[model samples]
Target: MKKMLVLMLTLTMVLAISACGGKAKESTTESTQQPTTKTEEAAATEEEFLPEPGAKLVVWSSGTEKVLVDEAAKAFKEKYGIDVEFQEVGPDKSIERMTTDGPAGVGADVFLAVHDRIGSAVQSGIILPNDYHEEETKANNSDKAIEALTIDNILYGYPNSVETTAVFYNKDLVPEAPKTWDDVIKFAKTFNDPKKQKYAYMWENGNGYWNFGFLGGYGAYVFGKDGSDPSDIGLNNEGGVEAMKFYQSLKNTVLPLKTADITSDIKKSLFTEGKLAMNVSGPWDTISLKEAVKNLGVMEYPTLPNGQPMKPFSGVKAFLVNANTKYPNAAKLFANLITSEEFQIKDFELLGNLPSNKKAAENDKIKNDPFASVFLKQFENSVPMPKIQQMNAFWSVHEATFTSIWNDGVDPKVALDDMVKKMQDSIASSK
Candidate 1:
């Protein structure tokens, strides 16, 4: 099934590219001829086609999301009489496997994916185009969450959860959350003790995903605001260089550790051990942090020195139906059921995931939760991570650029300029 879909997609692309070349005149003539009204009506009728019942369905999710998907599957089975199976598959591995399994007719009917993967999945023809519950989904989810799942103006998935990094502080060490970057720097200067392994704040500064907040806060962005224009790269601009300079200054000034020393494991260990006062992380750390720290407090990311809020990249996790699935209706139903407001609220209660559903987010339980509220506030200032395939090239370049500045002592401007050039080259090659 997936193989056929890929073949069709490849042929479509080939024809499109060819049409732009020597066949432009012929293709234009064919395209300009309007379809008959009867033909259009027939296409509309076919769009409403539904799959048969009693088809067994399989779903894949990460281990952390297993319980949520399992509960959803149970509810879906009861309501629709469709037998559903749930499997633990990490998001990255799921996308990778779909490239092979989908084409072979053995892929799960539904699978979880981060919003950023939508572009690649669509390009590969692995995920189906969603035409179910469009209005309900738009009305229920946050605009950014909805935007995340949209590729070239078509919805591809049902958003389940939305996440962005925020500041998590140890209440015992910091009486209150720092309000601004300068405040954080001052607090770090007074609180950090390299000799005692204590620090005021720490994050994986070398990681571009985490560092993007600072760059974005200062008017630097990976692409344009809409994230569609790859030619307008912003990472090496004046604001970006300034952000990098600030990031570089932290290594030996406010932060006692180097960028290479701030791996996620090390950061988690330090924070969990009460040696770190504050750490920038996402919801995935909530459970472990709560268990390790007696008094854990969450807050919106601090304001930058320029008085602008730190703009983290928001990532939406959604359920995507396999394009090649035999049970299209069942898969769509299951996807819709799992991302519904009720299930989103249940997921929040069970796993502390921040729901993409606006109604679920407005529930008293989530609205009143101190930890959850902070993330909600941060989301207001966050930017959706770009869904363009060019973004795939951006990640490695971002990492290398930051690593050079922080670890290799390369000049920030030089590193950024080189990084952007490399990124543009990569984007061209990817095309």
Candidate 2:
């Protein structure tokens, strides 16, 4: 009976040991398998957001921009192991090409545009609003540059360069930059001799783009304050008529040169030859002015007689992404890369472009450039060009008003009132 009891106890102990071994093996297997599942999930989440490794991106560029764009493309491809192809298209012609190609899915993934064309592009639905790096881009770029590119309070593109007209003077001719319109008039009385083709200042005064500063300085505008409303035109307001009268007085009293006689080429030649003391021009004239004149200097537009600064129309150059791009994420990444601080600085170095990136504009090279620095100062008081579609009609009306006042010697108020009526009719017809 004792042997039977002892054998029963040993069998029970062996069964308990077997159960303990099975539990240990199960725990070991679960611990090993759990981490593998979690690791796979983490990797997949990372891969989901990353751009495809071998995607190809197409870019549209102008011949003048080829060098900078090519360098940027090579750098982008090296970083992402993607391929980039560039098509040489002029900046002015890009909008038309995109309009035809975007809907067909044959347009470039990215292209450059002027800010004034944003309204038209948005209306046409060719360009897409930037969705990536919004905060980073706004924080790094100039406020005005960003504001110029925004339509209906939404940013449309990445601003790369900023340009506006400033007063370029000959240091030897003027001795000092004029501080006010009155000073310019005072000097012009003695300096200007139309018979000799010598003048204190010369500009395309009949063109709306160049003459907008005069009207705008007196509170005239093509559209409403935000530039989004087309019905509210301010170009023929009380201040506008008064501003026109002032402009006519200058042409009649101080400057005898007519708009037809003083073309852009003539103005450039006069300034380069030291026949003109001061001229209103933008950064595009920098290279030629530097080579042609020995004592070239730049200053902000002279203040008007009514204690207002001459607020020239400003334009920003930006890159827009095509709405029909197959690789939206990759296209956005490339846009950000091209507008980066490094690339902006390189563009300034190579092309003499005024960078819209605040950090890039602050570089020692830009800071030391006399011409560039004056433009930066003038930008403070400059107004952005209207982005409304009605601006197309406003140009012709503006030229007529200027011609009637400056060329035909018509009364300023009468001409402005007629211009307003014609402009309203044009706008109504377009709609």
Deviation in Å, model 2, residue 417 alpha carbon: 2.4
Report the lDDT tens digits of candidate 1 across residue range 184-248: 89898888998988988888887888988988898888888678789899988999898888888
Compose the digit string of candidate 2's lDDT tens values, residues 123-162. Answer: 8998888766677789899988888888777888988788
CA shift at 419, candidate 1, in angstroms? 0.8
What lDDT score goes with residue 388 in model 1? 82
Query: Superposing every Cα of model 2 onto the true structure, what RMSD results?
Result: 7.2
Find the number of clashing residue pairs for candidate 1: 1
| Structure candidate 2, residue pairs in collision | none
Clash pairs, model 1 backbone: 3-103
> Local distance difference test, per candidate?
0.86, 0.84
Task: State the lDDT at 63 in candidate 1.
Answer: 92
